[model samples]
Target: MLSDTDLQAIGLTLRLATTTTLILFVVGTPIAWWLARTRSRWKGPIGAVVALPLVLPPTVLGFYLLVAMGPNGPVGQLTQSLGIGLLPFTFWGLVVASVFYSFPFMVQPVQNAFEAMGERPLEAAATLRASPLDRFFTVAVPLSLPGFATAGILTFAHTVGEFGVVLMIGGNIPGVTRVASVQIYDYVEALEYGNAHRLAAVLLVFSFLVLLALYSWRPDLRKT
Candidate 1:
């Protein structure tokens, strides 16, 4: 049976995933919009950078982040000067890592959605005297709801499963950085197979159910 700590880990994982998803939505939406609309040659390089984490080893990414967020690192120094101190091995650090790790997941979907939309709708809106921001909120965003939903689900699920990056940067600080994935690792390391199994099963079922809802709910709207 899963213990109270195990349950807390599950709750923390969900909270972390939720926070990451929300931040990605706010941060990624504009980037994706620009990527879709921009025609500059530099956009390709920028897009590649945004997508690099998808292919890079988690440890490599985590290692770099660990250095960057360490006490003597740039982020740490800036935070320390401001009295915030190094964020590493803290909840905020976990949030930052999860944001970077999950960014591409959120961006790519919204970008694809915008690209598929093309300029037709925007042009049509312009004829109706709509401003760019107005058209985006009134036309583009509503049209991209499905894509956003898919992206949010995938990003949250991916964040929930993160281990290497979180473990390396978060240091398994209980109730702060000890997310479900790290807790599962702790269980396995102590040969607590039953606890690990339960946690793994819970995550599996939860992810599957969310994905099943996203994929199976709309055969008609999918054409968009």
Candidate 2:
């Protein structure tokens, strides 16, 4: 049996994951496309930067994000100057952090898909007088559906599982920053093993289902 607080945390976690995944698709698409298609000397460097979070400790990333978004930090100062206030410890702050944390999960799969697509379809479209933009939207995007699906699933799952980064920046404010992982941490810390088990089990089941769906999906069918 889940408590009201547990439900709230679950809702907030879903909201965070959804928002982060959507933003990643919008932001990561072009970046992935470029990484897949470009031959520039900067490609390796840019891809490395995009993949940094995978190797870096979540606490390390979260610490820098906290500092950068603090009232005295550059981002905080800029926001204040713009009359937008600080972003730390807010719902939107969580979104930002989640996006950073889950970026590679979204980008890498899509980039790989693009690379696997080779040059044939684009060339065929070009021969038909289709412009670069047209080919990208009509051909490249449609063919990359599998990658997009994988990216979206991975991003959402990763965001839902976030603990260290969210904890470091979010500060456990119920209905604001108190996500499922944080809530479970609280439950355990208070010796509330039952509640912790309930929430953890829910997360485990949910994550398993998401990955199962992703793996079972047939990308080839999307083409037909």
Candidate 3:
């Protein structure tokens, strides 16, 4: 029988990953759209910053986030003044950490898909009386579906596996911040290798299935 604590950790992980992916979709799409189409001088710097999490150590990111979300920090003080506590050590904090850590996963694929599309489809759409918004919704977004799927899956999976950042920001409060990755860490620390293996295998299988779907269906989804 699965312990209640384990079940709670799994549920929280899924919730955190789902919320993080949703936020990434909302936030990353516009940035990716701009990056793909814009010729601005700042594009390189902006892209690099977006991809920072991919290259930077997770502990470094977590350290920065910890400071930023601490009581006296900008984010913390600002939110506290508004009658809302800083979200650190809570579910929302986990979401924020996941989004920040998984940002490149969300952005790069969408950008690639958009770049792959080039300008022809939107140009043709404009010729057919489609407005900018219309062109994006009708033409650009459809062409970018595969990328979005890939990005969403990657972001969710990455978020699920996050450990250092969640530990820094969320502090392992069971049923609140005790996500599966952290739970696995606890099991390993307690020398329960069997439990850790079980959890890790589950995550591995789930990620493999998601990537398989993405890679297999991607070719079929290409624009004609």
Clashing pairs counted in every model: 0, 0, 0
Per-residue error for 77 in candidate 1, Å, reads: 1.4
**So what's the TM-score on candidate 2?**
0.97
RMSD of each: 1.3, 1.3, 1.3
lDDT of each: 0.90, 0.93, 0.89
The digit string of per-residue lDDT tens for model 2 on 83-102 reads 98888889999999899999
RMSD to native, candidate 1: 1.3
Tens digit of per-residue lDDT, candidate 1, span 94-172: 9999999999999999899899888999899999999989999999998888778878988998999898899889888
Per lDDT, the best of the predicted structures is 2
Instruction: For residues 1-224, write the lDDT of model 3, one tens digit per residue.
Output: 45688788889989989999999999999999999999999999999999999998988899898899889889889878987788788888778888899999999999999999899999999999999999999999998898888899888888888888988888889989999889989999999998888887877888788779877877787744
TM-score of each: 0.96, 0.97, 0.95
Candidate rank order under lDDT: 2, 1, 3
